[model samples]
Structures are given as structure tokens and as C-alpha cells.
Target: MKEIFEYRALLIELVKRDIKKKYRRSILGILWSMLNPFFTMLIIAMVFSSFFKFAIKNFPVYLLTGQLIFNFYSEATNTAMGSILENASLIKKVYVPKHIFPIARVLSSGVNFILSLPGLVLVILITKAPVKFPIVFSFVPVLYVLFFCFGVGLLLASITVYFRDMFHLYGVLLTAISYLTPLFYPKEIVPEKYMFLIKLNPMVYFVDLFRDMVYYGKMPTLDEHLNCIFIIIISLFVGVVVFNMNKKKFILHI
Candidate 1:
């Protein structure tokens, strides 16, 4: 924590560079960040909502809530996975702690995630979903999801240094993960036999927690809270352990 604090300037600069680079050539710039998810939810709601006839009320808000959380995880981890190799010049030239690279990537995506929240709020208001004062507390689960993404990002960034194929493999894996998560549909719609698989997905817990607070206008159950905590702890522990174990060899691979 102290080391991170000491290097806070570098972290901030890297995050800034990431956001700027992503929008450097675009005319709309950061507006695209919010529009991307908004359009995605709009399209999904138009097509799937009509095709499947989902029973859930205000389905667009439900879809956007899930998209917001899942998209953050996807963008953060995917960008972080390439952080070491993408900044190979800096890695070879400087002595900065390598973990900072991945941390910055995830944080940059986190900024975009927060920026996109107003779009979700707009959808909620348009759909007239029940809003309570407690909705402000949704930040708690968002923080947990951020930590989870950071841990996984660290692990991916470290491993990708050695196994370049992880980049391609993770793309496919993310697609599969998106389907496994109950993004467009409700849990009750899932068959009983396969419900356990959804329960096992860590992303499901984070999404459920967020939806409970934001979309459902209720507090998360104790089990939901415990599941998120367990995943965050285990992910951080393994991420630190794996990154430390492999970081020294990054130079050789990169």
C-alpha cells in the first residue's frame, strides 16, 4: 500500500495515458464510452426482449445493470492482460514495479466504468424503476468488483508475459463467460440442473449483488455478500502469489 501511495503520480499518469490513447483519434471521444453500452443495451432490449418475451419488468434496466458490471470486468482484465507487453519499452528501460502497469490499466477502465453510470441512471429513470436512497450504497459492490478485476488482471498480465497465447485464449473465454452469466435473462428461467453452474461463477455473484441494490432496490442476501467476499479474497491471494512468482522472469519473455 505504501509503495503504491509513493508511486501514485506514475499510476495517475499511466491511467491518463490509457484513457487518452483510447480516444485520441475519435471525434466523439469519451462520449463513446457511455454510448457504447447504451446502444448495446438498446439493441439487446429491442431484439431479445421481443423475441424471448422476458417476463421481467423494465428489462432494459436489468440488461444495462448487468452489462455495466460485466463490461467493466471484461475491459479492465483484457487491457491489463496486455499491460506488460504493451509497455515493453518501459519494462526494459525502467525499474518501476511491474505490477503497477496492470493496476493502471484496470484503474483506467474503472474510470470509464464510473463515467458510464449516468447512462444506467438515465435508463432507470426512463423505465421508472423504483429508486431508493439506499441505491447510493451500490458503490460497495462496485468496489468489490473493482478489487476482483484488479486481482484477476494482475494474474493475467503476469501470465501473458510467458504465454502469449493467453491473449487469444482469454478472448474466447470471455465470450463463454458472458454467456454463462445471466445477463439477458433471469435466474428463475435457468433450468434447475444447471443452476449450480451459475452459482459457481464468481461474476454472477458480483452482478447479482449489483442488481439487488440498483435494479431490484433491495439489499443483497448474506450468502450473496459472503460469496463475493470469498471470491475477492481468493482472487487477490492467488493473483499476488502468481505475479510475484513470475514477475522476475517477465523481462526474458517480454
Candidate 2:
């Protein structure tokens, strides 16, 4: 980790490059970061709320909270999966730690996620969703989710170096995960028999944590806090182990 701090300038440059490259050709530029989630929430609320008739109050805020958390995970992991391959030329020419590439990708996505928070606040104000003082500390779960994503991003970045096919497979897997998470629908709508599957998904707990603080305006339960911490620890352990094991061989494969 000291090595990463030593290369902090490089990481910062990489993150800035990523954020710039994402918006380079666009007219709105960084504003799109805020607009994308805002529009997504609007479209989702229109389609699901009107067609499905969810019973939840302030459904747009509910959907936005879940979407923000899940979208960060999806964007971070997907971008991180390609981080190694995308920076192949640099890796070949440099001796920098390969782990930085995925970490940089996750940080860049996190910037975008943070940029989109104002959209959530807008939805909250527009819908008049209950807001409380405790919601100010919502960053606690957000930080956990970020660490969880960084760990998963590391694992994906390492694996994709050897098995390029994993990229395509992950897209399909993410789609399935999106549905399995209660992003667009209410958890109560889920059938009793399938509730176990939802409980087993780590993303469910993360999303629930965000919803509890932001949407429900309450602190996450003790179990919810433990679940987030447990997943963060386990994922980081697996990610670092897999990444270290595979990084030396990356040059050969790439």
C-alpha cells in the first residue's frame, strides 16, 4: 500500500485522464454525469411506477438510491475488467504496480458516482421524501460499497487478463444481477420462495444499506452493517490474493 501512495501522482493522473476521456467528445461534458442518472431515474420511475404500480412512497427517490449504488458497482467493475488490457502498452514500458490500473478505474467511476449525488438530492426535494440528520452520514455505507467494488474490480481486472471471454460473460451476469437486485421493483413483490436468492446476493445488502439511510431515513441495522463489512473484507482478501497470484503472469498473457 505504501507503493501505491508513492505512485499517488500517477494514479491521480490516470483517474483524471479517464474522466476526461469519457467526456472529451461530448458537448455537455461533466454535466452528463449528473444528467445520466437523473434521466435514468426518470425513465425507470415512469415505466415501473406507472406500469407495475409499486406501493412504496416516494418511489423515485427509492429507485435513485438503489440505482446509484448498483451503477457504481457495475461501472467500476466493468471498467476495471478492461483496465489491464486497455493499459497494456504502458504496463509493457513501465515497472509500476499493475494493481494501480484497476484501482484508478474504480476511483474514476467513484468520481462520477459522487457527481451524480446532486440528482438524488433533487429527486428527494422534488418528491418531498423524508430527510433526516442521520442521512448526513450516509457516506459510511457508500464508503463500504466503494471498498467492496474496488476489491471486486481487482478480481475482475486480474481474471480478464487471462480469460478474455470473461468480459462477455460478465455482461450477461451483470444483467442477471441487476434484475435479482430490487432496483426497479419492490422487495415485497418478490415471491417468498425466491427470497433466499435475493438474501444471498451481496449487492442486495449494499443496496439495502443505502436505501435504509437515504430512502427510509434510518440507520442500517446491526446485521446490515456487519454484512457490508464482511463482504468488504472477504472480497478484498480474494481480490488481493487473486491479483497478486496472477499479476506476474499478466505480461506473458497480454
Error of 1 at 193 (Å): 1.4
lDDT, candidate 1, 1-254, per-residue tens: 77789889999999999999999999999988889999999999998887556477788988999999999999999999999999999989979888999999999999999889989988988888899765878998899989998899999999899899999999999998898898998888889999888877889999989988898889888887898999999999999899999999899988
lDDT to native, each model: 0.91, 0.92
Where is model 2 more than 4 Å wrong at Cα? 51-54
Judge candidate 1 against the unseen true structure and give its global Cα lDDT, from 0 to 1.
Answer: 0.91
The digit string of per-residue lDDT tens for model 2 on 2-80 reads 9899999999999999999999989999988889999999988988887555487778988899999999999999999
As a whole number from 0 to 100, the lDDT of residue 165 in candidate 1 is 95
Report the C-alpha displacement of residue 212, candidate 1, in angstroms.
0.5
Off by over 4 Å in 1: 51-54
